[model samples]
Target: MNREGINVDPQGRVAIVLVRARNPLNIGAAARAMSNFGFDDLRVVNDYDVPFAEARSAIDAAPVLAAARQFGSVADAIADCTLVFGTTALGDRRLQHPVELLRDAGPHAQAARMAGGTVAILFGSEKTGLSAEEMSHCHRLLTIPMHRGGVSMNLGQAVAVCLYELARDGAAPRTLPEEARPATAAELARYETLLREVLVTSEYDRRFPGNMGEDALRRLVRRLALQGDDVEVWLGMLRQVLWKLRQ
Candidate 1:
């Protein structure tokens, strides 16, 4: 696979997500890094439009920059991804997800791509990193080891480091069939919404309010790890249950 260069199953299975990145130069550099590693799916979650526009206008900007898609939120940016990884600096913030070192995460990400899953790696802003709410969307978190004195990396540098590690593995075979594809984050989110409604309608929230927080329910559904076909069945069943409760 090294000879073939990033043997992704459906062409583009890896996406780089930037949440609240503010620097135009960093955005351009991030795009350049994606191009360097032969990745093109760049999703930016930024409300401000000027930085994205300026990055695209940069003279040395990569082609991926021109075609990058802008999203209003991290959830929307990563909705189509089947597996989401968030990069963190491991500061004093309390974490709710399991964390993996940067070196170890590449194989897992490559394996996800080989299984026909779209993998998304998210990078937070230049100032503060991913918010607690944004980090909750990830299945697992990845952290780059740093010297004791170093707190974090620059936005563009962090993007480059993560992509470099991922690109180092150029030999994994792309083998999964389309039918075997896992359910996307978008589908899982939709299922979560419906299930939440069912819980509300059935008075489960009132009876068992302990487990009804949005983050808790989201983690609960993700723990199921339903496949594409399974999510449809579950959605149908939940709909029926909701309807019956309403009646």
Candidate 2:
């Protein structure tokens, strides 16, 4: 579909993720929104009830609801997605990932999709928003602007707003001097493992035990927004350092 000046094919590259949605009707509403925005990929993480596909609110979005994929965890749901965005109302909870305003996220998301990378936008349940653990899987945190009353939105409405902003076209895609390709989750995991090994070998973990060091390192790496080639280079460097430390 043509969004603003950009052509966005929402079928393959963009996915709408509902995490532990309690009401099936809300799931249905989310599906309907996806249909309106021309997004077909819907992924549900963890357990949810409400016979989503049969939801009456889904309207003509039955196909999208019926075809939705279910996953046991956030990691599995977004494994194939190069960019994962978790939507939050920015409650009192602490966040590790970079937080972006919904308006600013559109161009970045569209650019990622245009670069042939899959993107997943995640929404939490009606009762509780995404836990810190679940949010850890996301590359960035997305928050919608709200009044100072501290009120949050319903799951369905949140999904609709995010999709609308993202699907709306604004400016032409920026040109990169080099072809831009972000690292896949698998690549990032490999680099994380190698880097962790180097830390252990270098006794960095010993100096900072528990989640302090590990979490900090993980967050630092994610903030790097490494490209595919950067992953290889870092992995090789970490491996070499690990070998030298062991020797």
Candidate 3:
């Protein structure tokens, strides 16, 4: 069963975790940026070459990325984090109910300063954005304001904005235990199977048909490293609308 209540753990190294990111260069770039800000706790949750790209992007900080761990599932990456934040572009959508600001999150950091727990801030893929499932992993959602409408920043840019806010100096950690567990590969794969079937049966693939062959397509979905909760949210939507016929 899922954990009963909300528990926050303050006092730990904040992990700048990326889930299903698209580009190696961007991973390298984010890795470099994190190190610049004194954050070496980088975790890439994807079934791809996270370490390689981090090393390449390290430029001078290549070692930071090189030492970065690649997790096949999000759960493994965040097994120890006491708190988790998910970054989103949907400003004020109430994306994660009762979300906290980067400024407000400082308290938790302050609390954790000595408690020595960990925080994981998750970022999404580049081509589109974070998957519906990925967004659900976070205890709180962090969104950066932009002037222009429909404005979307690259993965590296998004990571930089978030890092500047939470991990920057003069912030305090929280006092709590931990967060919802990350999902297993078996759970994530079930959701992928659902999406894959949706692609095949739903009209999306046929209408905007592209080169999403099984293998290539699997890579795209797998990169997200979605959890069981994430999968359920997407499946719910597909069942309710996307798979339904227009009236």
Candidate 4:
């Protein structure tokens, strides 16, 4: 894929992927990162798109926020792309390409651009990171070199690193497709309400009493990075479960 306009600053195409994220703050942080580095395309796969707005992040990047895309599967997110990469801290194991240095990735990205195909970098959930199944879709793997003995990166930081790397060098800047919009702050709020109703009806409150932490639970639901259809399925399941519980 090595040719021209690949991985250079302000001249290359870019896309972001969030897989099963469980924190809205991280999503907000990512939006801010996009604004800071001039990247707008973001792909999410979860039962609920992360409610980044409620956390008070990604202030000016609202345009990017509005354009975030929802996907039912990772395959859908990176399907048409000419190349795909996954980020991880677990690349010490044997794989086609272990975590490569940003320097190395630069050349690879440019090559893909030369080949004329969309390129994407994938990320996973905060809890367990990307699964082997997800990683299989990537052509390369990048592991941000963390400080010695440092904890793995929070969602925002990881995104900032990638966006910065791609934009700092001036990857060809461009607008993302309609398919790249993430969930808005308002949509997330509605999903949060639905999530709470589901939980409340399912007797989750009885298990925790009056201090059931509805707000916190709502926040948890808001941060999950789910797409519209994904949310529908989750709510349906919750409804069915709650219906049975009431019986």
Best-fitting candidate, scored by TM-score:
1
The lDDT per prediction is: 0.86, 0.80, 0.68, 0.73
Expressed as tens digits, the lDDT of each residue in 167-195 for candidate 4 is 55553355545563456666667767776
* Best-first order by TM-score: 1, 2, 4, 3
> Tens digit of lDDT per residue, candidate 1, span 2-81?
65564443225899999988999999989988887778999999999999988998886788998999999888998888
Runs of candidate 2 exceeding 4 Å displacement: 1-7, 10-12, 48-61, 170-247
Candidate 1: misplaced stretches above 4 Å? Answer: 2-11, 171-247
The clash number for model 1 is: 0
Quickly count the clashes in candidate 3: 23
Global Cα lDDT for candidate 2? 0.80
lDDT of 2 by residue, 1-247 (tens): 3635445654558889888887878888898888777678899886544554346345465677878988888998999998999988887777888999999887778788889999999898788888888898888988999997866788878888887786555332333287769999899879888878877777877887774366677787788899998888888888788888989
TM-score for each prediction?
A: 0.65, 0.62, 0.56, 0.60
> How do the candidates rank by lDDT, highest first?
1, 2, 4, 3
> What's model 2's lDDT at 12?
51
Stretches off by above 4 angstroms in model 3 are: 1-12, 50-61, 91-96, 148-150, 171-247
Return whichever of 2 and 4 wins on lDDT. Answer: 2
Candidates 2 and 4 compared by TM-score, better number = 2
Top-lDDT structure, candidate number? 1
Cα lDDT of model 3 by residue, 66-142, tens digit: 67888887778888888777767774444644566556766665565446777788888776466667776667776
C-alpha lDDT (0 to 100) for residue 243 of candidate 3: 50
Backbone clashes under 3 angstroms, per model: 0, 0, 23, 25
Worst ten in a row by lDDT for model 3: 1-10
